[model samples]
Target: MKRPAGMSNQALEFIRTASTKASWQEKIILLEFVSGLRMPDIVASEFDLSPVMKNEYTRLLIERDSGKPIDLIIGKKPFLDFEVNIEDGVFIPRPETEELVENTLIRLPKDPQIIVEIGTGTGVISLALARKFKDARIFSTDISSRAVALAKRNAEHLGLSDAINFFEADLIHFSGSEILKGKVNLLISNPPYIPSSRIPHLDDEVRLYDPPLALDGMDDGCSVVRRILDLSIDYLSPDGLVSLEIDGLIEKPLNSYLSQSTLEFKKGVDIRGNLRFLYASLHENSFSIQ
Candidate 1:
């Protein structure tokens, strides 16, 4: 739909600059993204927005001018079969990661004992696992304290507080793997896999607003993958499988890491059909092909 008559291109440009470039519904969509308030409710309400809501909206507009993701302002993001709260500075789950989760879910054992998820941002994977495997115990960890708290709240609200445990620790350094030990039947993660040099070139919402701790994967983007693979060696059950999200560009390097490990892997394609997941299980033979 074209802009209304007499509305100068400059005015339309300003609106487009502030939000998306939708033709007719941009304004309404912007309202939905920022506040999650229905158009009818907002139009009919006689009560005023709470002082907190007013301040949040003001800050949201300022953030928008600078290109923060609207999901950050809306305080939530929908992930495979669920909605996860996304607080400021916490990483929002991307649609591409859903492919990783789906592939893992399909491979899960019907009566698995324990599952461990590293870098459990917003508990999207762990919570999803809980819903699928009600008898399985899940343990999830994140280096960010804020992410841990938010994930915990999400689990509680979903009535999964007892089924999942949230931990504040980095998988790269955590050594208490003996708690689950060799009983962990599955390991999963969507860790930082963005090459460090490429991070600065990402969109402002990703480079500026998405937490750096969750996006920077060091020089080659396989640093976290390497560390987590070593971590899984100690925690996985004999038949345990590990699944991870990775950058398609680093497939060779990532496969190299798999070559040195004792795990056999099957690659996965993402929503865009690019190979972006590595699902592996223990292989008795050492030094497999890259």
Candidate 2:
């Protein structure tokens, strides 16, 4: 195959060899490695291709062949308009999660004062919220110390450190919960919602590289969702909204569970039209687990 003009010989060779094992999208991973250009920039032809060191090109191919995700290989992933540093064991933010952020934004009250985010893996959701709601005080928690530290670093990088408080705690169990209780305007999460039994069936990119702590949702996949709902009863203001990213397959079971709560619930689909997000607001009636 003739090398596309402006493409370096090394890049062409990398694509040819890497294409053997990689899908067309995976083949695009070479642009990230060689030019540091994201898919959008590449699609627009806005970047100049440069020669990659032979040794580095060979090393990247080895990593790619080993089934390492390109985001991990590059040490960062794009979220919305910014990039967040990531490493192995941290859940990489997904396009669906970006949709989750947008969905939450439309539902938020103007001048939302307090926001709480659970399972802030790379802090992308909280960071995006902080950027949008400059006056809102946001608190985010992650069970992994590494995740918390990385998120703090991302916040510092984006000059949003003051807007968000990063905590190394399980969902909503951090030190600031006392102050946030009954005052939060929005409580949002993209918690683990995949059934424990399905973990092994996930793609190797997910099952092997992503942390189980961020994926496994215990039995029937609503364990964390249920916990978040139960805990929201204490933290959410009477008008506070709860937004979550959930498995599309669990809508029936989740609605059954939500039926027992005092929250008024609505569900939305992703761009693919799968039920993927849940939005809820507390009612005047008291919450109960039943």
Candidate 3:
């Protein structure tokens, strides 16, 4: 048996066969992962997979073949300017949500006293706000205690723990103090908006790995969105804005909701140019949707 660094090819063939569906290149990726060594570091070097490394390589390949998201496999996802660790059952951040944050930043007040984010998975939106408005009181809420705890950890890691507050609430029936009602200068959310019907059709990587709590939005995919809009009617301060990340399927219905509201309506597009966000402000004047 030919050997490089005392590793037998016949032994390598067993690892390859054990991977089931992973290709040769994928095996190399898995090898590099457990080796903690990049391709540049491994080139022309005496490379041998340690026992622990070999075990981990096989484990990761098995998980990968079983449809786990690559980001979750690595346990980290990059959003905007920083990488956030992913916990089991927490939704990984997506690029569309980053576009939502960018749009919100553009529309925010110069110095908002209070900002509230609903369904703040992993604190991505809130963390961005904390960095943008250093003095602002940022309030983030999630229905899942586990998600809230994980998000808090991410905030603390970024040194924004003292700058932001995280809370767990079932918003549908939440009964908090008036501080959030009519006092919030800005309200933002990337609520669950994927229609229940569409969930089964989602890619296995998402349907099988991402938390349903962060994806399902009932029948039309705007049930939670409607609730948020109702809350904003009373919660948003005068002249304040309500910004949301929405499914493309909800645009027409959302437009109708915005048209009836006392707040002025503004639409935004994501990086791919899809109508992915809706902005509303307390106003009487009319403006065309852009």
TM-scores, all candidates, are 0.81, 0.88, 0.84
Q: If the candidates were sorted by their TM-score against the true structure, best first, what order would they fall in?
A: 2, 3, 1
Could you tell which candidate, 2 or 3, scores higher by lDDT?
2
Q: Lowest summed-lDDT stretch of 10 residues in model 3?
A: 281-290
**What TM-score does candidate 1 reach?**
0.81
* Model 1 stretches with alpha carbons more than 4 Å out: 1-26, 33-62, 172-176, 284-290
Give me the runs in candidate 2 sitting further than 4 Å from their true place: 7-11, 23-28, 35-52, 284-290
lDDT of 1 by residue, 122-236 (tens): 8899988899889988889999999899999999988899999788989834556577766778889999998889998999778888899999998889999888888777777
lDDT of 2 by residue, 61-151 (tens): 6777788888898788999999999998899999999999987887765557899999999999999999998998899999999899999
Model 3 C-alpha lDDT per residue in residues 1-290, reported as the tens digit of each score: 23334345654665557677776766666666677877566655666667777688778988989987667887778889987888788888899989988877777654578888899878999998898889998888899988899899999899999998888886523456465788777889999988999999999988988899999998878889888888887877776788899878877667677667766777788888888888877763312223
Ranking 1 against 2 by TM-score, winner: 2
**Candidates 2 and 3, the one with greater TM-score:** 2
Q: Write down the RMSD of all candidates, one decimal each.
A: 5.5, 4.3, 4.0
The numbered model that scores best in lDDT is 2
Instruction: State the C-alpha lDDT per candidate.
Output: 0.76, 0.83, 0.79
Number of residue pairs clashing in candidate 1, backbone atoms closer than 3 angstroms, sequence gap of 3 or more or interchain: 0
